[model samples]
Target: MAHHRVADGKNSLRRRGVSRGLVFMLLAVLLVASGVVVWFQVGDHVGREGDAAAATCVEGPATVAIIADPDIAEGLSAIAKSYAETRPVIRDHCITIAVRPGDAKITLDGLTGNWDPQANGQYPAAWIPQSSVWAADLVTAKPSVVDGTPESLVTSPVVLATSPELGAQLTGKLDWAQLPTLARRDDSLTEFGLRGWGSLRMAMPTGAQSDASALAAQAVAMRITRTTGVLTAADASSKGVAAGIGALTEAAPRSPDGTPVGAATAIADAADAADAKAAPIHAVPITEQRLFQLTKADTTAKLAEVLPSGPTPLADYPFLKLTGDQVPEYAATAVADFFRFAEEPDHLAVLTALGFRGAAPMPPKTATVTFPVTPNPMASPETAAVVDINRLVFGPTS
Candidate 1:
């Protein structure tokens, strides 16, 4: 019995030893697997860190805020989206552009001073006002308001827009110089065979109204003074120019509520309504872009746009940067990159698609009727001259 018990004990000891050996092998395998996984994970993280350091991507992404004219805002926003998708890296960080459409007069007013938060919000990092006229206003008030020479992104010519009835009669019949003499005359339109139409009543957008209107007023001053090149501040203050400006303003339709009225509302209203014998306003100076927008928005309503003969003023959409000694290197670099991107032929296509003349100068796709438009930079009146004349034409808003 004792010998049998001893054999069973030996067998039990062997079984125990085998179980211990299997457990040891399993633990060893788990430890090896875990070590391999940990090695790969650490190596991947190190590699990515090395690449980031090499790429110099040291800062958080930068968001660039750009304030653009309401007229050009849609097109500008489209281009801004494309810029972001292209993934531009300025100063070693990804860039995002946020475009906000702003009023030309308010933006001009903001930079010119007397900025009320309720009237003008915080100044944007950069601005694309409707024309250099606003910039000229700044220069007249304060020269250092700009950091550098303003760059024009694209050129839009100002044209007279009227209801079909009036446009049909006036196309190519008169020039900018003829306006002052005719605008206030009771029989001005009747002379053009618009018997019941009263006068050649014209609406000129000024100050807070529109950049195009301001330019048109300057055109009148230039013609009145017989001055070429640019209308000087002296020309604006001259008796002849003031009289011309006043006459032009006198022809504008009176506001029903005794509030400010611009050409945009009148044109839009005419476009929405049927042709009537008594139109609210007869004619207005508008940009090619606006003419396109007015017609395109409602195909049923059409406006007759005529490029008045002689030296016509152009809307130079100038790009300006808010400059100060405090501007950081990154901010300036971002501005430069954005400007270059906007000027690229590929991106300028965006503007041309929207009926604008590109940086390369394309024939206005917006022109329904073909009139020769040779856009010369010299055609733009001096900004300072336009600014002074506007005070005479529109008077002060406040």
Candidate 2:
């Protein structure tokens, strides 16, 4: 019996030793796995840290993105480049201003929605829309997103651009009411020895899609309604005004393809054709500033401005900074710097040369123009929407 007990005890001892060996092996595997994981995590953290450091090294001191109307892009770009070259450091950051020129409506729309990177490039820190109405509209829609009060950078009232000869011929008294008579295809000018002026072909910036066109439409609407404060949806949809708008739109110049050309292109075409003693468009609704720019650029197409009786829409170029996290602190400061730089006396002179009228007194040699003391705000967003809808619904089919 004793010998049997001794054999059993030896077997128990062997089992115990095997269990201990297995426990040590399991602990060793777990330790090795934990060490590997820690090493990998440490290496990944170091890599991320290195990448951040590199990014910091390559980043500019400060960068500001500005989006301006395409019409004023060249001048704005020149100004931005010059400012960047001579600007002092602001908030310990040497600033860089990247100016991108885009369609006023399209750019505003992008701001209202998710910005399209492919179409609009990088997000803009600031916007220099063609008119304050755009900013007003934006504020109306998203007031919380508006950072600060939009400041008018410069002013340019809408004008009727005409060829030099045609302008000379129409030197008599004409008001906004005569636009339909003058623009119609009939031979209404026969009494004036002009015979047939080939139906006053005209061009506008963009029907309702742009402020230039909307303002012109509003001017025409005012002529129809004969009330100038604000054209409500009812005013826009009125049968008489709607019909007048249709006539005006129908008179807009179209390409050979029957599509309406943009304002800038239309002006360029008129300028090009004028050298051949032929004007493609008899008149166009354009900003006075734009007329100045055109005259300077193309000598053959020196356009004269025709101011109407009623209050006209003024392109109060507004300098506005975007709100939200997308626009960083540094960017806002940089944008403010550019705005201040632009308003400086020297910079204002540059703007004057580019045909923009500053808020300050008109400098020597600049055109002397008077604007209405109390001009209406560019159509409010709601009014603008109504105007656009009316345009699409009543646009001239002819």
Report the number of the highest-TM-score candidate. Answer: 1
For every candidate, C-alpha RMSD to the true structure in Å: 12.7, 17.0
Clash totals, every prediction: 0, 0
What global local distance difference test value does model 2 have? 0.64
Per-model lDDT: 0.69, 0.64
Residue by residue across 169-247, what tens digits does model 1's lDDT show?
A: 8886877878877777766766677766666666665444366666777777777788867667778788888787788
Shift of residue 292 alpha carbon in model 1, Å: 0.4
TM-score to native of every candidate shown:
0.76, 0.67
Q: Judged by lDDT, which candidate is best? A: 1
Model 2: ten consecutive residues of lowest lDDT:
363-372
Q: Any idea how many clashes model 1 has?
A: 0
Candidate 2 lDDT by residue in tens digits, 183-253: 67476544345654655666644543255555676677766777655667676677877677677776766
